[model samples]
Target: FFGDYPREMREMLSSNLPKFTSEEKRLLQNKADFIGVNHYTAIYAKDCISSPCDIKTYEGNAMVQAVGERDGVAIGRPTAFHGYYDVPEGMELIVRYVNQRYKNTPVYITENG
Candidate 1:
């Protein structure tokens, strides 16, 4: 993994994000042997920063809304957990994203349901 925060995160959070010193960067760089992902389900993310939305707990403070449906159609089959959908493709997408983002670092599905 990179030593510092991602460029997109830094841009979004701006001064809200803490800076890392050269020593911290050196210590953090490529320190992880692998990435562990606990994937439960995939939900559509709607940007609330640019548009108005009814903020919910699932959305946290990221200003992004977690939506399970679009155009009156569900993203996937619903699970027992509210707002969670069983979307198999999400696993593939997440794994691919993590692999590419982390420079092809080894990844393990630590938890899934």
Candidate 2:
């Protein structure tokens, strides 16, 4: 399972403790019959260059603990693909990258529209 980017890090400790990810790759090496990857949407992470957030700064959404607001709308620099927005080449690149890294691993991508 590729839990690469946890939407919000405020789970238990850090604000975006993106768990699993490469961790599972090591932990479940031969433990499971089928290796699964659940990737639907990608996200951009914005680490605080400062400290813990105050009450007003966090607002009511615990998910977005200390993000910024522009024109009264909360936003972050999404971890989206560099070119997927305009072309499908991004998908090809991802496949090529994955192949180069995991040369012999059986692969499956369980995604939906």
Candidate 3:
């Protein structure tokens, strides 16, 4: 639910993933005719202490962001909020990643934001 935030907060959130920003730049090298922007809530990420980082990461409820309940309940995948984040910024990263990893192509994020 990253709907409301001040400019300062927005700036701060945007800074969390520096690697994604860089990758976006690399993608612009070839460029495209049309540009599309999709928006959504940003996700929170964390490192797994005991298990491998990959295992700790889930695509359902847990998703890419590391979220935990305030009461210490371990939240796993399949929860309602798993992929429900309002992180539209992730679209930016997706476009950027695609541009950097593959040939530059016009991009449009079609799924829900």
Tell me the RMSD of model 3 versus the true structure: 12.8
lDDT of 3 by residue, 1-113 (tens): 11233455456454543343555656645455644545544444553434344543232223233454324544322235554444445666777876665454566665544
Models ranked on lDDT: 1, 3, 2
Q: What TM-score, to 2 decimals, does candidate 2 have?
A: 0.30
Taking the tens digit of each residue's C-alpha lDDT, what string does model 1 give over 5-92? Answer: 8787787776777788999988988888889999999888888878888886542547688899987999999989888899999989
lDDT against the true structure, per candidate, is 0.85, 0.43, 0.48
Q: Worst 10-residue stretch by lDDT in candidate 2?
A: 82-91
| Root-mean-square deviation (CA) per prediction | 2.5, 9.7, 12.8
TM-score of each: 0.84, 0.30, 0.31
Clashes of 2: 6
Off by over 4 Å in 1: 56-61
Model 2 regions more than 4 Å off: 1-84
TM-score of 1: 0.84
Expressed as tens digits, the lDDT of each residue in 1-113 for candidate 2 is 23343334345345435345566757745444433343433332343334344444333434233334444543333335431222234345555666665566665655521
Give the CA lDDT, 0 to 100, for residue 112 in model 3.
Answer: 45
Which structure among the candidates has the greatest TM-score? 1
Return the lDDT, model 3, position 27: 63
Clashes of each: 0, 6, 10
